[model samples]
Target: MTELGFTLKVFRQIGMMKPILPHKMLGAGLQLVKWGPGFPSGVNAAAKRFPRQLAIIDDAGELTWSEFAAQINQLTQALKDRGIEAGDSVALLCRNHRYMLIAMIAIMQAGGRVLLLNTMASRSQLGELAKRENASLVIVDQEFLEVAGDVDQDKVILAWADDDAPAGLPSVAAISADQPTKGHSKPARNGQVVIFTSGTTGLPKGARREEPADLKPLVSFFGAIPYRGNATIVLAAPLFHSWGLINFGFGLSLAPTYVLRRRFEPTRVIKDIEEQKADALVVVPLMMQRMVDADPEVIKKADVSSLKITASSGSALAGELANHYMDTFTDSVYNFYGATETGWVTIASPTDLREAPGTAGVPPFRTTVRILDAEGKEVPRGETGVIHVGNDMPFGGYTDGNTKAFSDGLMSTGDLGHFDENGRLFVSGRDDDMIISGGENVFPRELEDALIDHPDVADVVVTGIDDDKFGQVLAAYVVVKDGKSLTEDDIKTYAKEHVARFAVPGKTMFLDELPRNPTGKVMKRELPEFE
Candidate 1:
């Protein structure tokens, strides 16, 4: 994008936020130059500008911006005392809480890079991953002592402890308690933030995002969604996922009061939103599905009317789920479509959801989306092809030094999608997920959408299974609605009516729920094999 184009986009994005004073803007810019882009810069700036403002509210308690900064700076001092410096890697293995987020800032403040480890990952996997990634230290929660055990005990620091540390091991609270409270010096260069992708086939891949992330994503987000400055945001999603991390990092730039929960209980989510009077709610689609599945009586009792926007990403927002959520929440849903590799690609507003169910919506300011065939040629608007995206900040590269497929300045999203005549993008499924059974191509998204529309079908996923006769065939793992009975023949018949015979799954398995990572994407590797 040209300089003029970028300036207009930034102006439009800034215009969407609740107004800020000139001095505050200047202060933020100064922080940006010093600390670069990320939570630390935003935290320090907020401390100066809104010291008494509530910065975070979690299960433990609340902290104002001033206290929040002081705690991180103190922790920074402790890490520096331990000899942490720029470019050192510190893996964070913890759940969503104040300290987990605080540790991320402090690590960077102390010039240690942050490697976010997923809580859902097995202890061995987390340990192995940290070792493979060459992490020198780990900040873990008390609950994950077993995970921490995989590492040398001396290098571990508990970010959250229910009580005192185990066997006198250091904890963030302990280290920071004795440390002097003072501002930390800015690192020569901003520390990098590493996020691992939840790959379906193999062990996860690590993607490193160098700090001060591309402003394009921030511009893309605030340009479409009205997340006002200093508003309250309820982040029920795990802080490790890219989507959740985005709400914390860029979302912090807005200096909003973030409300976090240690766990996501659907009904409790309603209560939190109601109690917090949150202006924005961030979640993945699975959370929304469960939220809508919660008892109607509880939802009706809660007053979540203050929610101006509920930003959702991390997985496909099924057409049925999107409409149902909007119908219940009064059209406040905005579904974001992108990858950990690419930030915000498209945003489906309530109007988009209502008009075209399952549409990924259109690209936001200064972002571009294209449908390209295998040869890297652009396909027509209504044709299915690889979905490629171009924005200011796409993924830098995997830690293993591999890069994603790039063509004509756009990086592949590794998903198959198409655009409507109206310019709305619709993601079908993973590019690698497309199956050819008996010479008939099949996309699981079409069949999943069809089955989900059935009132008895609460949730479903269709995967291709190897078969002797056809080489591969579709297999469905479904979750039936409460008090409903859906049989194999019933599902096959329903699928036959809605999809091509060849596209119908040869096997159907019913479960109470699908196996999903914290971000809500179905863990295909965890699914039971077809019989």
Candidate 2:
């Protein structure tokens, strides 16, 4: 019997013998096998099981499993014909389109590495990443070709999305039927993707490669969750981001029908969900807020009963927003925690979210989290400290010579959080972003959340300023809604009523707009410093 068959048989036997311990044993075995290395195997298995099921959909077009597989095969052959080989890096700078998905599969099938670049990155940023990754070939969509102007055009394979595939360019469809069939390549034992950090501290650093073993636990975790195989998943976030990339992986592995939106629009998202009968969505907190702020009647009129789960990540989803989503969708909304370096370290199920509003959730299967102090010693439960993740999962270190990110078999996430008595993890904030005022530690998120609840406040950022007496004092930068007028005292009074006295911002500055990155994450470092 084949290894996969034997594994399945053993799994079945264990399932029948020990009903209670089956999940634990299965999770352990999956980790041992480095399940992500078996992605090609899983793809073959899925193709055989659901040959004609719809795989991807966008405004431009849609593709079935068979069509998707054929495209992957053709593209793999085309890339190989051009001298591409296994372990070589291929950078992709494209939007959420069908071609992008096909390219990703083809790259993996050819044993090449994929470097996902944000489509919104400027030419300079793209050049820096391309140089750092040493990308040999760049496959870019026609729209993003300008961003690659600095790079040599001869090294690029421009993919066209229109019906008339560009002439002169290599056609993925013309490759030989027998030309390097898909699913025949060896599984990548090392990392398959090199994701860049969000650059919250400084310029972005490339995180470690993500290995196949890292994905096994995710599969097991999702299996236990309430996701269905045929569920329609709407992708509102940019596909280049980790959330988007992981969702794509999930859809491919689980045989789900995926719907893609070029960009996020609150009204359009609600309309698309209803029109497409989408059953699930993955979004950041900002998107959720925009959706909530849109016409309430649109949400009421939209039929979202098909939605079984909605996942929020990238930033903490406030308790109020979580509750609002649960009430609006009438389904469970989950909060996930992890970085580009780690695929999925923790996840809060709908049940957990409803119970503990702002908790990031408990660690996923086969994953252990340690709250450690500066010296790397484990802190007592309920004491906030840096969060560390340890598992047999695949994780590549930074491309730069920064090995300090990992120590003692644990990858430091640089996040501060504490586990409650119930074992739920609540992220306080980034340790570096923490403010000390009068010798007391303060987290910016706590105050920002409170300030956002104020009616007059459209947006706010709380930062620490040098203080003569207190060592550091809190400052608030506000972006008030149109026609809304408020003074610093009014803002302080509102915040004081909601949060602790120390958490209130001592100074307030009104700004027309706050600087934000493409993904809507505030650029705190760019805020003007106050004396």
Candidate 3:
């Protein structure tokens, strides 16, 4: 078939599949085309449609669509007052609240790049990141002022300060109070958003992305996850991460009511879902685990049936955990598998999880997932290989000039995974995290999964430790369930029953919890050095 013929056929299939799509999706595309692609353009369109409807609910309270748009404009004007210009980098170091949300949109509206900074980063890490990114302005939450010591004093703005200001630094509220309610002039080019990798193995790197012209990817994403336009959403994931930011972007265009909190406290989160009657909850796997482990009565009281979808990403979801969440929430969980570099590769829908338990669902429309061996040849089904992906979201490459290896125009996801006969993907582990012990390639994830299956185990992380006899040996850090006890031998026995003897952890250590980054990835570097 001709290329044009194939493209037409693809669109025909999409129209047939999603005949009743939300009208706002079409409006979103038109708005982008008319006003040029940027966060401000989407917000302006939403304001026009739902002027009086609630757009955001955070710790600072709620704002209607019109109010939300006005704040964004005021913030943009304030940024202009401070000499922020197009293409300039503005680093945002606030938590999940109105301040961060406003800054993200305002920076783009004021013709500046939005550089999202992790709230969990230490002083040194924040300093290094700011310097590396060449951030022209650093807007920080007041609580994190200590970490902003290295940032240029003249270029600092404080937000979300409950206490009296630290003398000269301007607060976000102060800046937006006196500025114009209308948005600033259109920028020469649309500003981009840059998010940092979780940095499990090393220092974090930035993944930059520009505003998307085509809304087809977003529309296709809704088909996979079933998030309706204008649906109420509770964002539990940190906005600095890709997963949360993606949801926020959808909320902007779809004009959803966002229930935001500064932190992911299990009880409060459940209450918010129940009180807000939120239709969707965005979270990482660890946050879900915490919710599932909360007090039983509290969980029962929470009317989470309001939630139609619980979108999870940022890390692999253990099959056991997925099953538990689905059983609790009546199969409302949707596990999304992807990375910062590659937008979204696949989404494990409720039906897919019910049928296959752990399988990451088939690739969404226009996404391509390939599992290839070291030779760059496709591996047979059910055999693990390096996972590569191609999609509509164009990767802006790393700011440091480092790039993921690519073959045939598909970028490497840096993960090892295999597809089942049904074409559902299962991630095995990171390609670099594979341990060559006694000449056998053993992935830590396999051992971790085995340990997690134990009835007494609540959480587990497996790492390869140095060994004189074997090139390296497996060390397991185990977190037992509450009011439960398990010995090192018991864990070893459980592992022996589940996996090969060599793959069993050679050393076991008990811990109350595993150290994890903000995105819930196990911080392997922070683990204790085994004796």
Candidate 4:
């Protein structure tokens, strides 16, 4: 569709959904448009419009939009007083909590670049990242104090702690205690948020993103899902991820009540959903898998009836897992497919899951998905090729001066996928992970899917290894289900029944557990080598 048509469609969707919204909320959205595109602007608008409404609920307790805004402004002023000027880097290394959100808003509002650090990163990695980004300050939780690495004593701030506040550093609570409630003066430039890739394939690269020029993506999201003003959400996904940040950004205009937990405990998550009566859930695929794999009785007893949307991303949602989630919870699952660099490319609605089991669904209103060959030519629908995506929000190249190869104005997503006859997209594997055996090309996802179906197999990953006969053959690393046993032959027989001959694993290694990153992505490079 043309830009004019896309805008029209968005306006129409908003018109139809307007009656259900709070009075004058459309005026607030228009304010967002006029204020250009900055997170602080959207948040301040929400605070002014709905001052008394609940904005955040975390281990630190609840805060209304008015209180939320005040805390953000307080920290923003504090950063300014400490000589942290606009465009300076303020690295945030805390877990999911109200203070983390406050720090992000404050940094952006004060015009400081916000660097979201993965909490699981080692001290070496953290130190390297801080130096690479030229961080002016590092804010961390008390738990990470020992691992904060070398930084000026005055540049570090403790943002969250459960017990008594630590000495020698100004805690977030202390800084905000006597600070002003009003927002600080706007910065010279709208500081951007820097997100690092998950590093599943290699070393993580930092991806910088400026605020989008248009609100179409955000509007289109509301049209696609059931989010609205005052809706309550349990954000179980880590804030460091793209999916979690997207939800948080949406809340600026929609003013949804966010329920967050620092650590992910499957049972506690379910209990929070039940007690909070949350309307939606924000999560990664692995979190949903854990929820589905919970005790059937516990799942059955949980009051998930209030949940209208279950948004998942960050990894592939297996077909079986999607079906199981939809079956357990009234068809409320929505699987989103995108990368850290490209933003959201596709979303699988509940209906899409029912029709096409493992599909990532079609492109959203303004986005485009193309499957192209090595020569940059669009391939036939069913033929697997590299996935290229065009969207309103594209990453501004890597901070290390690395550029991704692009074709016809669309950026490569580094994924291999294909579109079916119904126009639904299916991710096969990474572009570099395809295996060739006996002159037949194979994708590891197919073999991995087949292996995961066995009752004894808990998780699995298939890698291509060198072999004299086929040049490159498949190797399987299997993690058996707890208290369950299966022989290598049993898995081989199951593979023979389910997939092509060339796709079957030549050798299988049983592991007690698969090594995964914090994001639940299997680090194949860290896997044990074959004997």
Give the number of the best model, judged by lDDT.
1
lDDT by residue for model 3 over 1-531, one digit each (tens)? Answer: 554554444444333223433664465456566667456777877776677889889998999988998998899988888888889999898889988988889998877889887777777777788888889889999989998987778888987877667887888888899888974667786788999865654457898876777666665576577776677899989999989988888556566889999888999988988898888899999998888888899988777888888999998887478888877765788999988888898899888888887677889877888999898999999999999999877778788887778988898989898999899998878888888889888888878877787878899999888788888878999999989999988988888889887788889999888899888988778787767
Better lDDT candidate (1, 3): 1
- What are the per-residue Cα lDDT tens digits for candidate 2 across 454-521? 77777787888877878877888999988899998898888889888788887889999888654567
lDDT of 4: 0.81
Off by over 4 Å in 2: 1-39, 160-191, 198-203
Error of 2 at 9 (Å): 15
lDDT tens digits, residues 180-242, model 1?
767877886677788987655456788887664446567666777867677898998788988
TM-score of every candidate relative to the true structure: 0.94, 0.86, 0.92, 0.94
lDDT for each candidate structure? 0.83, 0.71, 0.82, 0.81
Name the runs in model 4 displaced over 4 angstroms. Answer: 1-35, 199-203
Clashes of each: 0, 5, 0, 0
lDDT for position 280 in model 1: 86
Q: Where does the lowest 10-residue lDDT sum fall in candidate 2? A: 11-20
